[model samples]
Target: MVDRFVEGAEAHAMMDRLARKYLGSERFEWLMPGEERIAVIVRPTKVRHIVGVERFRPGGPVPAS
Candidate 1:
């Protein structure tokens, strides 16, 4: 839930899978969790609006009325 840390075999396996996908290697011992660095994940909880606008204009000059 909150302040959670990923540990153990399953989580490490996931990390290795993600590592293979991203770092092009499965044996990245350097990527292991340590005192200075730890695996952290953040997800979007809420989405309010996805807005867009469209305006069209002619390429050529506008004709006078």
Candidate 2:
């Protein structure tokens, strides 16, 4: 899941420190928009690769790699 929050640098710095401390180095990723916002990416514990396939193929099965 990805989420964005509108906050100033202080809030962003606080969240970044907490995230780094608790989430560790591999569980998630985040970015600061350089303004007044932050973007956080929460990934699945088990990763998957789906590079090429028809994403808009509704009701169709995903292509095997």
Candidate 3:
């Protein structure tokens, strides 16, 4: 499953949930939370980037300027 978050706190929470559901509670391989936008990188299975609200804008450029 892909994890997308609007805030850092949410992303962190999603990461924990996903790891527990998929990789198990003791697994450390999925420790790295992607970013404001994260993707599930299951090589042989699937590789996709899950974009979040942070990556969207309302009719304007949303750069961190």
The Cα error of candidate 2 at residue 21, in Å, is 1.0
> Candidate 2 residues 1-65, lDDT tens each?
44444356656666677666666553235563554555455556677769895466775444445
Cα deviation in Å at residue 49, candidate 2?
48
Q: In order, how many clashes per candidate?
A: 0, 0, 0
lDDT of each: 0.58, 0.57, 0.53
**Cα deviation of 54 in candidate 1 (Å)?**
16
TM-score of each: 0.42, 0.29, 0.33
- Tens digit per residue, CA lDDT, model 1, 1-65: 24456666656677777667666787546653552434555556775664673334665333445
- What is the alpha-carbon lDDT of model 1 when measured against the actual structure? 0.58
lDDT for predicted candidate 2 compared with the true structure:
0.57
lDDT score for residue 18 of model 2: 62
* Better by TM-score, candidate 3 or 2: 3
Clashes of 2: 0
Residues 1-65, candidate 3, lDDT per residue (tens digit)? 43432455655566677666665674335344553634343334475678774644676553343
Candidate 1 vs. true structure, TM-score? 0.42
